[model samples]
Target: MTRPIAYPSGSWPPRMPADLAAAYCGEASVDVFLRQVKAGSYPQPVVKQGRRQIWAKADLDRAIQPTPDHDIAADVALDL
Candidate 1:
């Protein structure tokens, strides 16, 4: 006997691509999202099942969070 894998309701692929787009770009554009992934700037899928790539919702959410802007001036004080 084999144990069944567990997943949240409505959690699956095809949906993941779109979800990633919406989470990152605020729209359903997987093409843009995939491009970023290919460029190594975005988070890749958490897992690969067979031929399908799967991403965790939490991970995707984290990737879309806004990064804090760095201020170079703040790091250095000019003495004139």
Candidate 2:
């Protein structure tokens, strides 16, 4: 099992691209993250510098939070 990445306090380069983000989050592959972003369900990028899409470490931390039970139930109901 891969350990999650830890950001240093007041570190330089607080943003990360998809591949590093995937590894940081312990995701199996970068494609998993890319698909979610393409699907429009993932957190929006903070900025796009050249060809690199960037997200804040804080934003990615927030994105991994589990949705509330009520919200999950509502989504499940809608799918039915």
Candidate 3:
């Protein structure tokens, strides 16, 4: 018999998908998020367990912070 894996509280599971629409503005998709990382527009996520990529909540918060010259609408569109 195989034992099930367990996760600690507040940690995203390895290979788990983010709730992007709920967590991001303008209904961003996971692919868009990955694209943003590839484009150097956002912080790169760490690979968990040498197999999965997980985004830190802090990094996402930093990416969403308002800036004077930033266009929120454009960012949303690009990520959607």
Q: What TM-score goes with each of the models?
A: 0.49, 0.58, 0.52
Give, for candidate 3, the lowest lDDT window spanning 10 residues.
18-27
Q: Which stretches of candidate 3 lie over 4 Å from their true place?
A: 1-22, 25-27, 73-80
Best by TM-score: 2
Alpha-carbon shift of residue 55 in model 1 (angstroms): 1.0
| C-alpha local distance difference test of each model | 0.54, 0.67, 0.53
**TM-score of model number 1:** 0.49
**Order of candidates by TM-score, top first?**
2, 3, 1
Off by over 4 Å in 1: 1-28, 70-80
Task: For model 1, name the residue pairs that clash.
Answer: none
Query: How large an RMSD does model 3 have?
Result: 8.5
* lDDT digits (tens) for residues 1-80 of candidate 3: 32233333674433333443213422245566556677877667654456456666566667668899988788668756
Residue-level lDDT of model 1, residues 1-80, one tens digit each, is 32223333654434354444444444335565666778865667877677677666666667656558855455345321
The TM-score of candidate 2 is: 0.58
